[model samples]
Target: MKRYAKAVWHGSGKDGSGHLTTQSEALEKNNYSFTSRFTSTAGTNPEELLAAAHAGCFTMKLSFVLDEAGYYPERLETTAYISFENGAITASRLFVAGIVKGISLVDFEACVLEAKVDCPVSMALNIAITTEASLTD
Candidate 1:
C-alpha cells in the first residue's frame, strides 16, 4: 500500500528545472521550474499536485462516509486550494458540492466534515484544513 514518485532536478534552485514522474505514470516526466512555481508559467508544481491529491482524497473519502451513513451520492465535486507562505504550506481549503438522493443538507455536511478530517491526505498534512460543502439537488 505504498506509493512513490520521482523528481529529477538540474542546476540551481532559482535557475533550475525539474521533472516529476509518478509510480502510476499519471504525471510522467512533467516539467516544473521556478517560474512555473512562483509565476504564471504553464507547468506543474508540488503545491498544485498536492491540491489535486487532497481534493481527490477528500472526495473519495466523502463517498465512503456517505455510503457508511446509508446514503449514495449521485455526484461529488471538490476543489482543494493549498496555501503556501514563508516557504511553508499554511493551509488547505476544500470546496465541495454533492448531489445525493434522500439526504439532508446537515447530514451531507457532517459527512463532508468527517471526510475532511479522516481522509488520508488530510490526516497526513500538518496544516490547517477547512471545508465548505454544499448539498445540491
Candidate 2:
C-alpha cells in the first residue's frame, strides 16, 4: 500500500512559510516556516514530522512483534530523534521504553531490535537507525 501527505510553500528562504496536511487529516493546515525549521518556533518541521513517523511506525511494529511472540503489551513508548546537518539526515535514533507482559528482558530487547529493523518507516529511511529499548516495571 501507499500513503501520502501534502505540503505547500510560498515566499523566500529565511522568511517563507508553508502548511502541511495528511490524507487522514491528522495534520490539517499545520503551519511551518524557516524559523520553525531552524529554530524552536511554533508549528512543525520536516524533522519533527519524520521523528513522529518513525516513533509511530516503531511503536506499531513493536506491538505486532509482541503479539506474534505470545506476549501482551500494555504500552510501548517510542521516541525518534532525527538529526539533520550539512543538508543531510545524519541519523534516526529510536528510544523505546515498553510496559509489556509475559516477556523477559532479553526477549523483549530482541523483539525491539527486530521491530526497529523491520518497520516499514525504518526500512525506508536512508539514514542510520539505532534503538535503545527496555521494559519498565
Q: Give the best candidate by lDDT.
A: 1
Candidate 2: residue 35 lDDT (0-100): 94
| Cα lDDT of model 1 by residue, 4-122, tens digit | 99999999999999999999999999999999999999889999999999999999999999999999999999999999999999999999999999998899999999999899999
Q: Write the per-residue lDDT of candidate 2 for residues 1-137, one digit (tens) a residue.
A: 76779999999977889999999998999999999999899989999999999999899999999999999999889989999999888899999998987788999999999998899999999899998988898
Q: Candidate 2: misplaced stretches above 4 Å?
A: none
TM-score of each: 0.98, 0.96
Clashing pairs in 2: none
Please give the CA lDDT of all the candidate structures.
0.95, 0.92
